[model samples]
Target: MALTGAGMSTASGIPDYRGPTGSQRKGSPMRYEEFLHDPEGRRRYWARSYVGWWQIATARPNAAHAAVADLQRSGAVGAVVTQNVDGLHQAAGSERVLELHGTLARVVCLGCGAVVPRAQLDRRLRAANPGFAEAAEGVADQLRVNPDGDVDLPEDLVASFVVVLCPVCEVGTLKPDVVYFGEPVPKDRVERAYDLLELAPALLVLGSSLTVMSGYRFVRAAVRRGQPVAVVTDGATRADADGVLKVAAPVQELLPQLVSRLASEPADALSASR
Candidate 1:
């Protein structure tokens, strides 16, 4: 089962990071280069992110997360692969899972490739930027999660935003564990998900538009193998054309139902396992 983009998490109270219909930095999600190379742009991102981080930190998993976990426990789903970094599935007790785009709970040092949990950075940010000392006054519909997994501020506050630097490394910059634009998803990761597909006869996609072919490529593979594809989302998705079961509704509502309907047998659960 694939938990997709923004539409998947709306019930969790997290805003969609992309689209005019969604929230956060507000255009088609910002380009990775802008966050890395541009100063003012970077500041805008960090400021919004700083405030946005609290939203993600305090956010809880909704029914979608619970249902998926239930599906796993019942041996109906082998693995729960996701593009979201919110860590909701694990929190809900899903054992075998894949973070396809990476996770926001962690930050990676560009220089040495060491990973650090974002909670540590949050503490540092509170000390470094006193505005966050109290509590993040939630921003309306911010991506909350960014390329660096560092901080996200609202658009209104972007102009006056300041960024917190990496405390552990002298010169290394921090980046979100998620795949950024222009970055390629590890081939092994994609192939590993395909491994799970080999065990199942279908790929059920929820909440994603499948615009990022990195995640959608598996859908294509599922089709090539004659695996059934089902999708649930309120918005138009890039993979709508490929769906055998398309439900124009929120995934939070449909996932639990779909999981309930799945026969209780996990013979083909998770990334193509032998």
Candidate 2:
């Protein structure tokens, strides 16, 4: 089984939250509770997202993503479970991928439970706030975009930003489908990941710090089951002590070579193996 995280997408132009260079933004991200109860928080989030969404939406899968898909095709990998919300794995042709966190490509209405494409919301936002994208572009060089489609902007700009309501239910707010910092991962997603890990003989971790329990719990469970765990990442990870093999390297640089070597083995043997 393979588990991936934010670092995997860094090569694709999306910045990871906690990397060697540190977080792109200094302050804490908007939490689920704050987003629910505070209209201002929603305004700030959507405004930043309006500017940053283009980065994520236009991002292309890098070598790391392609290598993972190739590994899966070669039968060297059984399943992929990612903490990333980006749809790169699916875009790269990996079939059995499970997104531990929900995708950013979707939005859900808070009141009516209606799910809609993020593109639709983007259109609505663009229509409501004319010339906003052009205005954001003026300061594009001064800010960095984060993995969650948020950008750093001044307080006054955020305060003046307008947030659109869900089209399905005009009175309801629309939120991206991703799991926020304070929100728990859905139980079904956790169970499915556990099931994938339980069946695998070994667990391969790619580009994750594993600092959060959501991803770390699987490493712990694998250790308890006596399954060998290997980790490949650029920086120190929480699971380093438990990992049987730890390689410190960028995923984009390392994965293609790893996949090539793994693909040299007999297909049937590899399929029956790790």
Instruction: Score each candidate by Cα lDDT.
Output: 0.68, 0.88
Question: What TM-score number comes out for model 1?
Answer: 0.81
RMSD of each: 4.6, 1.5
lDDT of 2 by residue, 113-181 (tens): 999999999999999888887777775676677878888887766776778887877988899999999
lDDT of 1 by residue, 64-156 (tens): 888778777765566777887777778878877888878878878777777888888667766667764233454434344432333444455
Indicate the residue-level lDDT of 253 in model 1: 82
Among all windows of 10 consecutive residues in model 2, the one with the lowest summed lDDT is 19-28
lDDT measured at residue 60 in model 1 versus the true structure, 0 to 100: 84
Per-model TM against the reference: 0.81, 0.95
lDDT of 1: 0.68
Which residue pairs of candidate 2 clash?
none
Q: State, as a TM-score between 0 and 1, how close model 2 is to the true structure.
A: 0.95
Query: Which lDDT value does model 1 have at 181?
Result: 73
